[model samples]
Target: MALTPFLVLGFCWLPYYKTSLVFKLCHSVSEAQQRKMGHSNVWNSHPKNYGPGSRTCRVCGNPHGLIRKYGIMCCRQCFRSNAKEIGFIKYR
Candidate 1:
């Protein structure tokens, strides 16, 4: 099946859809050919410098609820689990 522009664009945006026909077709092509076509790298072409995408948790790579305070750079869940090890003391 031939790929449409919408399919190619959608493939780039929704990369989690690994079962997509577009992804399957694209992977059939050699990496060099994919680079020449310029669609395979579209998903990662943009830099995530200043948003949730840029700030992933250091411990588990979770993007949500990231704790950037004190440069912890961990998600809230990981932080809570490892807080004592990292020198945090809970007080009542």
Candidate 2:
């Protein structure tokens, strides 16, 4: 069968399609009802591109205490737990 742009290679919905569906649903509601739903619940929920909000730990998704040195994007807790495996030699 031929594949369309919307059709994912795997059985999963892409983020773009998911957010588009949400916007469509929100648009279907009345203006008053849409206003009551709040900005966060409807629009203005786009991903952060800059600033602290853009960076998050790869393992735990924590926004704070991230060790970004040497391209390590994990929080301190995750780093401590998997330090050895990550090639970090700790000296006692």
Candidate 3:
């Protein structure tokens, strides 16, 4: 009977590990909306870019558009367009 409580305690550790693996901000249904709007970061090879190619720019699909090199993610262009409306800064 005492062993049952210890087994329950061990089971608590598994859920903590699962939440750590969730990295992507959008997925499934949100991903579909992003695709329909022509804003996805899928990498393609067109004989340029040299090493491995680049992701489809989420801003304008330019392939070489402004994107962070670390994660290849891009925010909506509307962010820059409505910067002051949203109280954001660039030089700060």
Q: Which clashing pairs does model 2 show?
A: none
lDDT of 3 by residue, 13-73 (tens): 2232344354242122334453554443454323464432544545566544444545544
Clashes of each: 0, 0, 0
Stretches of model 3 off by over 4 angstroms after superposition: 1-52, 69-72, 75-79, 82-87
CA deviation > 4 Å runs, candidate 2: 1-40
> Candidate 2 vs candidate 3: which has greater TM-score?
2
Residue-level lDDT of model 1, residues 1-92, one tens digit each, is 44323324434543435536556544343445546678755868888799678889989999999999989999999999999999999997
Ranking by lDDT: 1, 2, 3
Write model 2 residue lDDT over 6-92, tens digit each, in one string.
423234434435556454432233445435656647575788798888999999999999999999999999999999999999898
TM-score of model number 2:
0.54
The superposed Cα distance between candidate 1 and the true structure at residue 49, in angstroms, equals 1.7
Please give the lDDT score for candidate 3: 0.43
In Å, residue 59's CA in model 2 sits off its true spot by 1.1
